[model samples]
Target: MPSTWTTTPVTAGLVHGALELEHTANGILPHRLPARARAQNTDGQLAMAESQPSGVRLVFRTRATAVELDTLPTKRIYVGAPPRPDGLYDLLVDGHPAGQAVATGGNTLTIDMSTGTVEHGTGPVATLRFTGLSGEDKTVEIWLPHNETTELVALRTDAPVEPAPASGRRTWLHHGSSISHGSDAASPTGTWPARAAALGGVDLVNLGFGGSALLDPFVARAIRDTPADLISVKIGINLVNADLMRLRAFAPAVHGFLDTVRDGHPTTPLLVVSPILCPLHEDTPGPTAYDFSHLAEGRLLFTATGDPEERAAGKLTLGVIRDELRRIVTRRAADDPNLHQLDGRDLYGEPDHAELPLPDRLHPDAATHRRIGERFAAHAFTAGGPFGDGTG
Candidate 1:
């Protein structure tokens, strides 16, 4: 069992921050031992298996004594996952050092704070110790490990947090692709969603998942079941990039997703957002890639193109989808006054593109994340705005 110690002076003030953890395959040991008895199979050897680690657990505590948390039933947690592990690992608050006992021979490590035992396995788990916390109107954050591939499995507070104040402040629930999920963002709180939530003074529920926001029914169902005062769905770019759906099916799927949410939040303010400007997909659809071979030659080139017929068919541009969404929402707004629409480009456009080119032309950079967050907060949460009514 691992030992614990209380670090220095006991500060009485509240500790309002996040606890986070991230996972990847960068430092994992191989499962099978090297073979010395048989010759290596050099010919047509399969490439190294992709090291995608999942099922990570994180636990932590808060020190907010003056705030009554039972009113806020749920707390928001942020997660980040990059494709490759280039010496990158997730950040853990008060985590034990990695070792054979803590990490074993596998990548997955389990930290059971309740028992002070840290061990390695195929699965990972971390526990948060919320021992001495009492407060009123306080917010605590649990930041996931940074710069790693991990998913948030569950969240529960030591005590149920009170719901948002009935008379003041608004809550914003925004959903989008990996960009909103902190892809390429510097930190969990630095993600645009978190940034926007802070700037708007609203509670955030970041449902952004890396490469997982494909208008999935499960996602929409999760949103439907969740309670929110304001909500927005950012769509298009991911669908186009993944080639997830063609025109015939995309529109209906989006409508159905929204329809399910509306059944639960009939009068709540909801916004449908289209994609920002992505030049590669603006005129040409794509399976985009960067030419890394030129790195040694002191040059970098990016290559991206999609099915010529698909481009010609006008099937994958953000403009096309935005038009469809606008029409859909406009038609629905005839009876639903709370429904609204916003074009993503309005927040980040070609003009801004000159200054903030996306790192991979898919996810925004850190600076752009800030800019996008500010723009979103200003538009969606200001007084007299669609979401300002506070009807949740």
Candidate 2:
């Protein structure tokens, strides 16, 4: 710890990236969804993703040379996998990537899907520290691990830390699946949404929930209530993978989702993006299943297990979802000029996929993330684009 440093509580007002904070006896746990919104959540997948804090960060102003955070992370471990990687904490000074960290100790949750059981292992909290910060008062953003569930205990700094002044940048609120949550991105800033936020010159509030982007009403409510100059929803991928709804339920669901968001952000630029090219699920319906064929080789893969014929019964594939989304957006745009649609393939298509195939047969690699972010900024935010100021 820095000599004679002051400590600060991890309060709701201090955290920028998280939607809500779960104040516990040990520390404050950041939640991507608020209590009212989370109350409707029953799916374990959504529950897990909400607690991961992908784009959530702690933003404050400080002149400290050194800072430390006591955190207890709930790290998940699959029963058969060798071991998961440590979650990273990416730090930014005045919006520039500066440092990175990883907490050491916390409770470990092990799960064996084959047995449908979970084992919780308790451990001590670990303090992550960073030093040599520039002396000038500067805005600092501590991006939490995108893949880990972290409980922030306390913050210590050589100098007092206060909420960072708003950048006065337009807030871009984005919602998507795992790709948007940064499944394979190198760091928090490396995520496509973060990269796009940088390129688009906007503030980011990423609501990208991994497997939870199933067009849930609560998610739509959250998006509707949040203040955003520009709003985007990267739909379809999670829908196809989860096979949560069929054609009949999907169209109405999409309509309802957008309607709910429009209730609050009637005029905000809303971009509805389809799924990126995932050949595995383009034609095949899914409830994507794990392919442990080469477990010994330490290579895990996923496959769409649902039959293509199921589409006739209203089962959704990426292609089906994309077509439906386009139809819905075009129809809606006829009435609402603020609504727009962007094909996900434009960001990551055939050529890009060949060079940077989704390493997991799902999530794009880190480099691919950069490509997506850059493309998104060009397609959505640049002049003459859907979200360009000229549109208004």
Candidate 3:
């Protein structure tokens, strides 16, 4: 029989010292901004709506000599979809499947979901019990549905803990599309943001979302709200690919996004980056392949272009976007001293392209990710650089 653990209530803004993660089949996607949808009507008014929840698993890495669940709620682990008959939350310890928690009674872990109990379902709430684990590093993997979302309310551990000491290192908050999110990178840590953070000896809050990095006011609001010593926003590819707005609207939208972020970080060094070279979208931009053949499966599938057919008729390539971004920043810098711009080609260009071909011709492969990280560290983080003085 498994040991029984106490249950605790989860409150908003509760800082759980535990390192929380959501499970993704490909890898872990960071839970940063809330997901939303955007569409404009004939009247040119934009509409926004809440997006459906996706499945995510929570993985935790720990160095506890011993482990136990001090607080296990009886509430059902709410998955977004209808009750899955065979769905089970599998808990793996140290890479071994330790046990399974079955979904039952409306998938609630506690009795009478109305009361918000922690113990629900057919099994005990505390399904995991560990011993002789002191001083040993262990990985706990929880595989959950990507469509189903869950909030980590709280965590309690029995290990000796010490807070991280305050360091003089600066914080770098970066906002970008999938690339910034570490998409298609070989490993989570290998993502360019992570690599650059390590190389620059700074803390990072990566707000990169795959296919969801369109310039949204809410996202800019989130960036403005986050505390950081340095910041950068990478734009362009998503704009051109989605073709959501024309040149007239694109420039203003970028300016508005920056203005909102600046409301909170007026003096912080801000670097605006353009897109890298993509042959498919360069110059001629109609109907480029969005979804490459999932090599895991042998089939070629394509997704719709975000850019409109008319605008894409004479597609603005990555090169064109780089030049425009440089010009925009240069002109804006005349007034905003702390604002700077970076050409994506500076990180990866035709020469780098000849040597390392991106698997999808969109996102960079692992090798290119490393090269980008190294170059970004050299240019953006070095002493006396644009981002070094915390000034524009």
The candidate maximizing TM-score is: 2
lDDT by residue (142-208, candidate 3, tens digit) is 4332122233333444553332234466878887866776655554445687678767877566666
TM-score of 3: 0.64
Candidate 2 accuracy as lDDT: 0.89
Superposition error at 331 for model 2 (Å): 0.5
Candidate 2 residue 365 Cα shift, in angstroms, is 1.1
Model 2 scores a TM of 0.97
lDDT-sorted candidate list, best first = 2, 3, 1
RMSD each, Å = 12.8, 1.7, 10.0
Q: What is candidate 1's lDDT per residue for 240-346, written digit by digit as tens?
A: 76676777887799889999889888899998888887776776665555545555555444455675567556566676778888998999999999998888998
Ranking by TM-score: 2, 3, 1
Query: In model 3, where do residues sit more than 4 Å from their true spots?
Result: 1-30, 34-63, 66-158, 286-315, 389-392
Cα lDDT for residue 293, model 2?
82
